[model samples]
Target: MKHLRELTSLPTTGLYAAIGTFDGVHTGHQQLIQAMVNQAQKTSTECAVITFFPIPAIVIRNIQTPITLTSPEEKAALFEKLGLNYTITLQFTKEMAQLTPTEFIDLLVSNLPIKQIWVGEDFTFGHQRRGNTTVLSQLGMQYGFETIIVKHFLQNSEKISSSQIRNWLTSGDLESANKALGRPYSITGVVKHGDQRGSKIGFPTANLAVWEGKLLPASGVYATFAQVEGKIYTSVTNIGFRPTFVDNEPNAQVECYIHNFDRNIYDLPVQLFLVSRIRAEKRFESISALIQQIKNDAAKSEEILKHAEFQTGLLTGSTKTAP
Candidate 1:
């Protein structure tokens, strides 16, 4: 897929495009993208995906509650996995927000080969979200294009949405969140050097420098995987303020202790995949008590992974792409 940042000029005229923030690229997004791709193939047009960076909320009001499910690079990768021909990353800015419904459509029509457009039923755009499907459809008629409003994809009578996934994550309901996402709820971050407390205790952990404003699940010990050096290691992750040391830290930290592994990954990047929440974080009476709990957590994490039919989302190798 061609990842584009700036709109230059029209390359071709017959393109089928789906436009959205597509944070999680969750099941709902998968359904919509599938529809777009199917329509594009049937109409002999190129498939395109138009998304934004920093999101609209952050760009407009500076309200950053939207815990991004995927970064810009990761979003493009997912779109590529879905076999889209073109992926455009529009920068959401104040100027872009000022466009009226007609003007927005005109801009896309003028710049992109947008023969057909796909949006969700609840999709709103143009100047404080004044444009709705009705306006979009009218513009489609005026501009000689097609407007398709895909209904909200539901799972078990609940709407599958990125917001819902965020709520699930905050609640530590990994199963429900993963169900909505069609994959494990995970976090990717660069390893940051922390107090070498874990290593000193023979349980060296790779501290993750998670993106600011990204929502983390509840404070707990979880069965997870440490994806480092392109290898998946079964590990126990503690997401909490380390109470055993009695520090002044209030923010919850993600610390992954890979079993029987010792390597210096202070500045390396790692992806931590949460398989299940093992137990809530607690303050042990002493260092020995905390160490014993860590050992038990490691053992439990290994057991959970050992019996799995496959590691979380093809840890060894992934051969599948989007449907």
Candidate 2:
């Protein structure tokens, strides 16, 4: 996909576009983008996806949310995978956030050939979210472009949303969240050198420090899968400060000890797919105690992943897949 970082960089006028933060690009977001693609194909116009960098919420509210399912790079990659003609990512700023509904539309229509716009039914924009489907519909008529609003997608009668996915993740409900996301929710990070404590304990782990601003699941031990060197493996992951080893560190961490596997993976990028929660993180009284618990956790993780299968409308179908 051609990534246009600025509106002035747009090379053509007739574009069909959809706009959103698209943080997770979950099932609902995919539906919206698919609708945009279908519209573009019907109109024979260039299909573009417009999203903002530094998500409006983070830029405006100064909140450091956790790492998302898809980073900006991953989002663009997914757009390319979906065959979008272009991907436009803008840097959110105070000035841009102040634009009125009409002004925002004018900024795009005046710079490009915008023949159609697609967004979710609950989409909002402009100063203080003053713009909505009503405003876009009115402007579409005035600008001679078509506007389409996709109704909210649902699963189990609940709206499939980014927030809901985040909640499921935070609660370690990976199976439920994956059902809503159409795939396993994963976090990618570089494998770092750890304390080697796991090696001493017979469970050598790959320490993963995720990219900044990535959301992490709740602090606990979980059944997970790790992808390293293009190969996937079953694993157990711990996300939290290692209270058993130390008590003063404030930041939590993610460490995965792959089961039935052993190889050097330091500095390699790995993606961890959480499958199920096994237990809460706790402080063990001794190293031997902790090691024994880890053994149990690892065994349970294997069984959980062996039977783990996501259902609902999101997944393509049901199959017993490890993680």
> What are the per-model C-alpha RMSD values against the true structure?
3.5, 3.0
Cα error, residue 125 of model 2, in Å, equals 0.6
* Alpha-carbon lDDT, every model: 0.82, 0.82
Tens digit of lDDT per residue, candidate 2, span 1-323?
A: 79878886466658888989888788888888987887677877788988988778876787775546667777887787666999888888989999999999999888778888899999999999999999999999999888989999999999998888889888878678877777767778899988899898888988987887788888899888776776667889999999999879678899999987777888999888777788989999999999899999999998987776533223334444343
- Colliding pairs, model 2: 13-113, 14-113, 66-213, 66-214, 66-215, 67-213, 67-214, 67-215
Q: How do the residues 1-323 of candidate 1 rate in per-residue lDDT, one tens digit apiece?
A: 78999775646767888989998788899889988888787877888888888788777787856367778877787787777898899998999989898998898888876778999999999999999999999999999888999999999998898888888888878889877877677788899988999989889998999887566888899988777867777788999899888566767898998877777887888888787899988888999988998988889988987764333431234422111
Candidate 1: list runs displaced more than 4 Å.
64-66, 309-323
Stretches > 4 Å off in candidate 2 = 8-13, 65-69, 308-323
Clashes of each: 0, 8
